[model samples]
Target: MEHAAPQAWLLLALWLWPLLLMALAMRTQWRWLPALGALPALVSAALLPVGTQLSLPWLLLGTELELDSIGRVFVLFSALLWLIAGIFVATLMYREPIGSPSGSNHFAQRRFNALFLLAMSGQFWALVGVDLVSFYVGFAIMGLAAYGLILAYGDPAARRAGRLYLALTVAGEVALFAGLVSLAAHSGTLTPDPSLLAAAGGPSLALILLGLGVKAAIVPLHLWLPVTYTAAPIPATAVLSSAMIKVAVLGWLRWLPLGAVTWPHWALALSIIGLLSAFYALLIGLIQRDPKAVLAYSSISKMGFLLLLTGLMLGQPDLLGAGITAMLFYATHHALTKAGLFLGLGLYEQNTHQRRTQQLLLAGLIFLALALAAAPLTSGAAAKYLSKPLLQAAPWHWLSPLLWLMTLTTILLMARFLWLLRFPASKAGWEGTAAHPTESSAHFELNLLAPFLAWGLLLALIAALPWLFAPASFWPTNSANLLLALALCALVLILSKRGRNPLATLIGRIAPGDILGPLERSAQRLRTQAGRFQPGQRSTRSTESTRSTDPTSASETALELKLRGWPVAGALWLGLGMLLLLLLLAGAR
Candidate 1:
């Protein structure tokens, strides 16, 4: 029997190897090597048994790495997704024509590969590390490295998206850093376990939620996801949607006192926010013309379910086991299926010339879509059944109908995605080269099969798991639910064909990243309005008129003047502090 001591290095390799590959890529010209970088992690995840631990006292204030149950599942799916996405990246680099034969595109490809490996390294460590500092280090690295991937295309939109993503990521990082410091300080330990944080409630928890919530793509904080993922390279988007997003969910699972503490206010608030985000993404997705944008919105919608489950766990701590299991299973299902769908889009772009190939691609699309919708026999179905008990419980019972409604919307959005897939390549922003007559169909088939097999294998695993280990009742055999979902899917497809999708048209008016546009416009208008008021000109205004001409403008100018001065702003802050002091004193009485 292999002892735990011998396997200590495996945990380190799982994360460090990618960084090694990243460094090698920076120094070498070989483009294909980085694609194989994830193999070590994948192999380790497959062979390593649970309960493996490695303690490093030399690391920052003593860090530990372990493969617990959650970490194992996370490593399995994350390594698998990264491995496949790496292959897809290699394929794109090799086959796709990029900006003439000049080596400039190759240089960009090299940069992309390095960044990809760095991001993968961060994601792996974030899940595997047990310590707070280790997790935060990994999370921050992943967040920063992904920005390069977002701007890989170097387009105007990609630049804009990269800036937006970076801004939110930085804000989240600040919150997360502060939260971790608070968590450590309050708990009186640098190496804090999540269970210990149960007593360290308040701003520590709130700051952590705000930080991770941004990465989780929770409502309002989620505007960066659809924009960034949609603009990133296809392979980058694949791992991003399938793997990187899970980091946030895992962070919540690892850092928060989910079942350990009762937080009714935050729990209810999170559940409500989750529900709104789900429907919000679905509605926005219906109108999007870009297939990638639709997938991004769909990802945000799926994330809402995870958030809801997390909230439920907070309320019903006794159900933590079930909730976490459901989340793991759901994450696994989404990672594979979503990655497959992205590659499916890439496959179609590459093989659009052949009629037979197009049909086969559509079949694959339907398979992935149905699985995502939680149709019978799919992994999503298993996940849904596992989570059903939680959703059906007390206060959450009110959300049950909404859950089904969300499913209906999911089916509709998937249908919309499939419908939009039929559009011309240019409309979808596909950059595939036309298939040469000499290019064999087998070549395209191989590329397409890479992601499909990954997706299909995951479905098979989930389906067999329920039958092999779970009790008969645990199977997703709710025939009525499946039937209802299928009927809704069919109804959506039918309505879509006759140009009678009135709801889609009406909801479609709201663009992808719905609130961002208005927010941006409002900010710009504020800036423009601010420019109209000269700083010293306020004195001139007072000299010119004895009577206030425009109360609104005068009030705005005065507010700006107060904000510009340190003394006035300090006095304002002092007055607010006194007010808060009085309120706290009164409350204490």
Candidate 2:
């Protein structure tokens, strides 16, 4: 029994290991602590058996770790990816050559290490968690900690991306929380409850769907992703897009009513949205210049497929047996491939003379995985084959074409992403060596390949999983639709090369945060208006002119300048006042 509940120890170790590492990292001469930190959780998760459950009555949330078959798939996949990225980050942990020497304690900062640890804890906890509340705590902590990374690194553009990410993330979290609340209120007393959540009926189910929708980067909530992925450091972007985002998927898997009533209408609507968003992101991705940005958009496209799967599963909760397996298989596929690409792009920055060679290699890998996304007869093809029966049963067969379109666009985007990610050597020698980096050693290259190789191994498992478990008779899969889809995508890419320049043309025309452009512009306009209205502008002009003529205005102008600073200061003070009043109101209530 003690061994059976080992997940409790695993859960505790996930949190405590990082904290210990961070504390040790704080005291040691170590600069690359982040990379070393993710190891224990990864190893423990792999060793832990599926169906294990753990409880901690002492904690506020009473920590839980339960492993369903699908959750096990996600846990191992996510845990491995995080560790690999951590290692990659560790390789670069020493200060940039431009900074102080290696031995300097300043090479690492405690704050950055702390945030990384907290984020990793959140991610690990979320992956292994059994119930809704435990999952939420992990999810919230990870989200907040990741925001810290954004603030730590982003400049003006990064900050804009940060703000966009934060706003959308908060909105998503709110929806998810609402769903949990509704679930707790409605579930019948007879139902068994997961430690994290009290069960509610359909309304709670709806909440979980909506909440997961935002976090999962489905359709409308997906816009912030490309911006954040583009702006973040390669390592940060890799984990953020790949592993961190899976938190939402895990959330939906654990919290939603998979075995309860199916919502076909909602499911259908979601499938349509996923189908469209999947293609739409690729189209936009095709036109973009930055490869990281392209990968971000590609992630959105890939995530949409998962969203569609979620919809289908919701519609036929009874099919959860196959549905959960399919979903797990699909999630693992995307995580590995996407993380590999993000890290590969980061490493692609290393090659100098072989730009075209690198580009060709990159394009091959991108399309290979994207084809998997399309379920081209490669293992992904088989995965897609499994999904067909579910879609065929839906009210309309036409949805299949939509699915094909999603697959085809993924092919096009994958091809386009390769071209965009291609390192153009046209300006070759003009840029310095920094722009064209080299692998520090064979070891470094191998270190970087860790995540990609891990993904490739998982993709290999696709062919084996269905055979071992369900053992369905072969339907004799056909490549005709797959070929037709690829050819059409190729033709589209060739004929519409002109559209590739649209990202530049649309930059000012379309803000990076998708629909938030208008709001951002409005705020900017308001600032401009405020700048003019403030007597500060007029006073500044007078003060400058007066410095040459009337000395008193210049002196008073300095006073005015000091007073202008007070507005920002005053705003802070006012914010504090408002906060105090709210706290008082809460106390009264």
Candidate 3:
């Protein structure tokens, strides 16, 4: 109890510091602002013990922050990524100052920093907040603030991505709000326990799932991911992918009654949907030209795996403890590995002129990609090893074969990602291809060295993760999947070399955001057709004018115009209001 006060303060500072720095970042563009802003959270995650609770009853009906085992892991990995991304961004800004030659660029940089810090704060808040209201508020803030990051360049593609992101964010928020309200009303508390969740209705569950599914990038709700990832700056994309999307899974763990009851139907349905999300993303991802878009689909596929774990837990209450542990471990591993890949991609593109640097960057990218693909002895393999128990324990017999298929597809997806990096899009876009080439002398400077070191540290973490989580025996057991994937990849390569390339025609055939194009065109067509029925058009005006000189026709037209006017509309509204009041009064008895 003597140490409680300091721990409480540290917990508060974790999120508060970022908000304070966000304000400072808006006024002055400090290169280290991103790194500095994330420090408190990192420190808190490192020092605070699990089960440390800080309650603020006076705030927002009531608010509580706690660092459970899951929260600690989430905060630790997420803050680490945010810190590394910050360092990377700061290095870029240092080398090419944002304020040089143009106030517009400076302003844009400042806005990006501010939004970045705000999003970081919201991420921490959502991760630690134990109450439903606090979680929802943080989740909403994080989701909405990311729009600014996605819109950083203000280009047409960025604008389009931003608009789509904003629309989906708002829709998700509305659904979440309604779901939370319904859940709280039924459960009689903001901090939901198993009992509270058990009392909640299916509608609340569906609403909450729909709302969080958007953030999770579940198939139909995932339209924003590919485009937004391709358009957003590298650092923004890294955090958005690694940190923000993972929050949806955390929310599920916190709110769902995984171990309390069995819902076999919901379980089966979610499992199927999860499988679909995995395969669907894989198919679309394989054809993507942009590396970032491929990663976006990869994220979708990984989230689908987590969702599968969730469904299994819902059905088999006994698996909750092991399932939670596996999911957290997997999420942490993916987060670090994916962020490293993005950062390395940025490094590769920036240092393209230097052969040695390009080789080193490519090597690092391949290592991370292999780890992401669950190659033996890496973090990804360990994650899969951890999940085997859950998969085996599941009642469904077909899950094992599906898991194997997913693994094979994941390898293909990663290969596609690496292959596309060799031929980056010629158009000057977010990868910084349009920027001037860096001098060889600049390679060893502090600006470049710092980002490399940060990235290196992330790589070290990824390599060490498997040992930290699994035993020595687990490493040797998972080599079968890796072997099969490699053999399949080799066959495809040989086929391509023999002048009968199967995938040659499929490259770039399907655009990013696969269904979005058709949906948008259909919407545009509907709007065009709807325009034909609108009143007061030129044709209608011409017809009306032709009859204006005849007395009866003029009288009728005048009456029609008067009925369309505000005065007549107001009278009709009043009449409807009175009728509603009379009906209510009569029904009250």
Quick one: best TM-score, which candidate?
Answer: 3
The estimated TM-scores of all candidates read 0.83, 0.77, 0.87
**Model 3 lDDT per residue over 11-84, tens place:** 77888888899889878978689888889889889988889988876556577888889899999999999999
lDDT of 1: 0.77
lDDT of 2 by residue, 1-589 (tens): 2454544477568656776775675455454677666777776767776676776544443455666676677767777777767765555433331123453534235445656777888877777666556677678778867875655453776777778778877777787778765665565321235432323555666667676777677777877787787776666777888788887777766776665666677688778887877887777665555666667778887778777787787787767777777777667666766776776666556533454535544654664455445443444555666666666666667887787666666665565555554433122211112243344332334443544454345444544544554334423443565566568656554444444432334432333445556667799999878878987576657756767688786788788878645245445644874786576456535
Candidate 1 per-residue lDDT, tens place, 277-336, comes to 889888788767677888999999999989888888888888888889889888888888
Q: Can you tell me which runs of candidate 1 are displaced by over 4 Å?
A: 1-4, 97-104, 423-500, 504-508, 535-589
Q: Against the true structure, whose lDDT is highest?
A: 3
Cα deviation in Å at residue 228, candidate 3?
0.6
lDDT accuracy of residue 26 in candidate 3: 75
User: Cα lDDT for residue 434, model 3?
Assistant: 32
C-alpha root-mean-square deviation, each candidate: 10.4, 7.1, 8.8
After superposing all C-alphas onto the true structure, candidate 2 shows an RMSD in angstroms of 7.1
Model 3: residues with Cα > 4 Å off, grouped in runs: 1-4, 93-104, 423-445, 538-589
